[model samples]
Target: MNTDSTRRWLALGALAVAMLTIGLDVTVLTVALPTLAVDLHANTAALQWFSSAYTLALAAMMLPAGALGDRYGRKKFLLAALLLFGVASLACAFATSAGQLVAARVVLGIAAAAMMPLSMAVLPSLFPEPAARQRALTIWITSTAIGLPLGPIVGGWLLRNFWWGSVFLINVPMVIIGALAVLALVPESRSAQRFRVDVAGVVLSALGMLGLTYGFIRFGEYGWGNGLAWVAVAAGVLLLGAFVLWQRRTAHPLVDLGLFQSTGFRWGTALSIVVNFAMFGMFFTVPQYFQAVLGVDALGSGLRLLPLIGGLIIGSRVVDKALPKLGTRAMLAIGFALLAGALALGALTTVDSGYGYTALWTTVLGAGMGLAMPTAMGLAMGELTAERSGSGSALIQALRQAGGTIGVAVLGTVLATQYRSELGTLNRDPISDGVNAGVSVAHQLGDSAMLHQVQTAFVGGMAAMLWVCAALCAAAAVLAAVLIRAPRAAVGEQQERLDDAPHVGQGADASESTHVS
Candidate 1:
């Protein structure tokens, strides 16, 4: 490879490592919660905040961070965000109290918000070729996917051998390496035109996302009966509605509302959200199944997820080769088909089912994610111009974040309701909490019958949730077949037409630009 070619790949490697840190932080805390409760003298509410603070901050800042990166420089913001992430990780490690850790986590989330969108926004500038860009994106996405399962493994090891704070400290070296690599390898890029910041749009979008994310999180924790969660969800909807109306009227909108005009961008983003909804829901439940039902520890549970990672790698590598021939529409249909089939198989799990069965279905599930996610992401991002990429990428990520959060809430409700129903008269007091708690109660009482009942109830609940996920995937497969357009050329002629089109916002030419495809 030439020097420029080598540098671009190296830069992508650095960005991927940075992305891995963000993904790791998303789940690593789950493993550390018990340790944190003991070390920090934290209550249940405090433990929930430890995770929610990061999630809420991430949702709130995503849109504004992307807009800022576009206005300033993506490289500058990304580099700064990396350094800040390292600093916040340090803060989290040293924090003596739950409140302090929560504060540090919020900062970590803000830095991550900048990194997620800005890292993606620069990909077009790095690899201008459509084929090369898809390859790079697959690698980038796979890094994040790997880190999600790795989180529990890493965290479990740290907690076992070291201290709880070591989980946070682990991010430091990766951040340092990523920051230096990004600084040395990546070039700066931003919008050529200077536009005023849309203060109204930023405020509205930030608050709306925060409210929406927090509401779903609350709902997951407290169930549909939580009045506060409903209020927050209602308020979020109203604010987002207002933000959309304001975007149409504002001279400089935070997001280019016109991006939705492209069929590829709209369908790609929507399908991507559907994939995340199923993916996040599975992650939320499966670990619990391993721990509560199968009698595995955190580390063992994490190890079992290896099949998923392996399957994802296989599927991504295949798509990187096959996507050109099959096209996004067909690949998406195939992916959702695999997902539906795998989830349907998973729904057949009973208390007597073995790990081999779980492994078979999870592998297929991961393969489906690999095929669908990058194809859908590439389709949406393929429509973006360099000028609007930051905001456009952010818009896609924002909706995805919302979808994943809602999935956890909705699926958690399904599981919890079914679990309670199966428990019947037995679902009282301590047993009502969750599978883990119910299992603990059964063991403590040394009641074999109660143990059998708890295990059966949890398996039934899990099966019900899997069925719901299977139905969603089946629906998405049909939609992908109907809605997504197949590519007409090998080199992505549609993308070329878009790139050569006039930039949006040039008066009379704006409307013309919106209709490029």
Candidate 2:
């Protein structure tokens, strides 16, 4: 390759490394949750917050973050974000309390919000050719996927040898390397067209998501009878409705309402959200099931996730070859069908089901995600013009993040509620805190019956949650088959069409234009 080509690919690699950190943060904490519950004295609600806080913040700030990067400079904002991410990771590692760690995660999310959109926005500047841009986009996305499987393994090793905090500490070196690489390799780029920041929209979206997530978490902790939880839910719904109205009327909307007019964009985004909802819910519960119920250590639990990752890799490869022939509608239906079947099988898991059984369903689950996620993303992204790519990507990402956040909150609540009900007046206060806590207490008191009860309760709750996910995927399968129309042209042709459109940030060199892919 030529020197310029080598430099561009290297720049893409830097962005990929940065993207890897954000992806790692999504799942690394799952394996550590059991340990956190023990060491930090966290209840189930607190555990939910540990994940939700980050995602909620990401969803809330992503649109604004994209605008900021456009107004300032993508490279400058991205560098600032990386630095902040490193500092937040350190804070998370050294946190003395669960609340402190949650606070730090919010900061990490804010930094990640800036990093995610801005990194993609800089892509066109590095690779101006359509084919090269497509290749770069694939590399960027694959980096994020690669982090999912690595998260458990890396986090497991850290927690096994070091401490619960080491999982967060691991991000430090990666952030440093990514930041330095980005500074050296990536060029600064910004849009020429200035836009107003939507302050009210940001506040409404943030508060609405927080209210909804907190309401579900509260319901999980205190049950459906809590009037406060109901109030929060109601208020959140109202706020979100207001947000949609504001988006339609505002001259400078955070999200472009016009994108939803395309059938591909709408269904593609919806299917992606469905997949994320199921995926996040599974991630939330399975690690706990491995450690608390099956009596595996963190390292063992992490290793167990390898089968799922393997399946995901295989599925993505298969879909990549098959998508051109089969079309998106058929692929999506097949993907969601696999998802439903696998999750249904998982729902039947018993305490004595063994690792082989868990491995079987999880592999299938990962394959389903592999098939659905990429196809869905491509379908949505194909609809964007070069001019709207940055904001459009932000909107899609924010919605997916929000969906995952809601999934954790709702599915976690489902598990907690069912577990508490199954416990049935057996010193419910301590036991209902969490399965891990209950198991620990039972062992300390040498109560075999209580241990059995806690394990059984947790399994029951997990099954219920999986059943809900299975039903959703089944519905999505039917919908995908019926609702998603075949594209008139191939993805390559769509990309060519996008290239034919007027580029944003005109009169700038390839290294300095703000035209996103």
Candidate 3:
């Protein structure tokens, strides 16, 4: 390879490593949550906050982070984000209490908010060829794919051998390596246009996401009876509505609302949310089940999750090979259908179900996710130009983060409710809190009957959550089938138009319109 070619691949390597650290951090906490609860004396709300806090910060700042990257420099912002992520990870490692850990997670999320979008935004400029870009995206996405599975395994080993904080500490080395690689290899790029920042839009969008996400989390803790949840939900809705109105009216909006006009961008964005909702929800529940219901150790739980990781890799390869002939709609619909079917099958689990049974369905679920997520993302981001890429990528990722946040909150509530109701005669402090607490309590008391009851109740809750996931996946499949257009030669045509369009100062005066592609 030539020097330029080598640099591009090296930059990709750095970007992939950066992306992997973020993805790993998200799921690594799952295997460690039980240990955290015991070590930190945390309640269910605190445990939820551990995950929700990170995702919330990520969702809230994504748009603004994108805009900043566009204005300043993508590489500069990414490097800073990586450094912040490293520092935050160290803080998380040393956190002595639940509150401290949650605070650290917020910082980590802000850093990730910048890193994820900026990393993706750089790809189009590095590889202008469609085929090369697709290959790069696959590598980029696969980093996330690898991290999800590796999280439990790596975290499990650390939890078994070292302190519970070891998971966060592990990120330190990866960040150092990534930072060095990025500094040496990646070229700085930014938007050609210097548009005014939409301050109102940023504030409104951040608060709106915060309220909506917090409302759902509060619902899990206090149920529908809480007036605070309702009010927060209402306020969030109003703010989001106003934000949209402001974006339409503003001269230089934070996000280009017109991107929604593209059928690919619209449905593709929706489908991305749907898949993550199902995926993150499942990740939140299963680790708990392995430890609480099946009596597996952290390491064992991680090992059992291997089938899921394997399936995701295999499924993505399948889709990549088939995309040329089957096109976007057919492949995405098929992938979603597989996901729905797998999760629907998973809902049939009983207390007696073993790893063999769980693994079968989880593998299929992973495959379906691998197939759908990257394809949907491609469709959403395919239409964006170099100048608009940062904000556009951020919007797509912002919705994804929102979906994951809501999914965890909503599904976690379902699991908790069903578990509490099924607690039967074992209504007590720890038992009412969560399955993990109940299992710990039962073991301490040497109460085999209570243990059995806790296991059975948790299974019942998991079944209910899986059923809900199945329904959502089914709906997404139908939407993709009906809405996503076939893959087209539109990118080349659009690029030509952009080239021919008028330019005034930094901004292009082209229509920036998109046809179905």
Candidate 1 residue spans exceeding 4 A from truth = 488-491, 501-517
Q: Per-residue lDDT of 387-468 in model 3, one digit per residue for the tens?
A: 7778889988988876776677788888878888899888778688888889889999999999999988888898889889
Candidate 3 lDDT score relative to the true structure = 0.83
Model 3, residue 325: displacement in angstroms?
Answer: 2.6
Top candidate (lDDT): 1
Ranking by TM-score: 1, 3, 2
Error of 3 at 40 (Å): 6.2
Model 2 segments more than 4 A misplaced? 1-6, 30-53, 94-103, 123-139, 163-165, 184-189, 420-427, 441-450, 507-517
* RMSD, candidate 1, Å: 2.0
On lDDT, who's better, 1 or 3?
Answer: 1
| Candidate 2 or 1, higher TM-score | 1
Q: What ranking emerges by lDDT with the best candidate at the front? A: 1, 3, 2
Query: Model 3, residue 310: displacement in angstroms?
Result: 0.5
Models, CA RMSD each: 2.0, 4.2, 3.0
Cα displacement (angstroms), candidate 1, residue 276, comes to 0.7
How far off is model 3, as Cα RMSD?
A: 3.0
Per-residue CA lDDT of candidate 2, range 30-130, in tens? 87998899888888778988987886677667877876676667789889999999999999999988899899999998999888888877787677664
